[model samples]
Target: MGRLTDKVAVITGSGSGIGRQIALTYAREGAKIVVADFNEEGMDQTVSQLKEMGAEAI
Candidate 1:
């Protein structure tokens, strides 16, 4: 099992770049991931990706 399984996480500036990658990586490990960004469109895309990864961002 992943170390982050069932854990919750909040990531900022995750709409793009490193932050986004971090969020995705964490989610893949079974963590609840939150992607926050000033870019609305970027945010949407990231959120969508996270959802596909079986994670959710609030």
Candidate 2:
């Protein structure tokens, strides 16, 4: 199991770049994610990616 199993992380600026990478890592680590960003499209993209990884997100 991952270190973040059963955890939830709210990541700001997760639309792209470092923030996006962090969200992905956190999700991979078994954390549910709340991806927040000013860019709606970017946020949606991140959320979609998270979903593909079987991670919960909003």
Candidate 3:
């Protein structure tokens, strides 16, 4: 199991920059991600990547 197994994470401004990185990292740890951001592109990219990594992220 990952470090954050079954955890719920809500990340703001996750469309880019440090926030995005944190969101990705948390998701990789098996946590659910709430991807929020003003940048639609970044948000979509993050969402796609998280899904590819087998994380339940949005």
Clashing pairs in 2: none
Runs of candidate 1 with Cα error greater than 4 angstroms are none
Q: Higher-TM-score candidate among 1 and 2?
A: 2
Report, for every candidate in turn, its global Cα lDDT versus the true structure. Answer: 0.87, 0.96, 0.90
Error of 1 at 17 (Å): 0.6
Worst 10 residues of 3 by lDDT: 49-58
TM-score ranking of the models: 2, 3, 1
lDDT of 1 at 43: 87
Estimated TM-score for each candidate: 0.89, 0.96, 0.90
What's each prediction's clash count? Answer: 0, 0, 0
Report the number of the highest-lDDT candidate: 2
Q: After superposition, how far is residue 58 of candidate 3 from its true place, in Å?
A: 1.2
Angstrom error at residue 58, model 1? 3.0
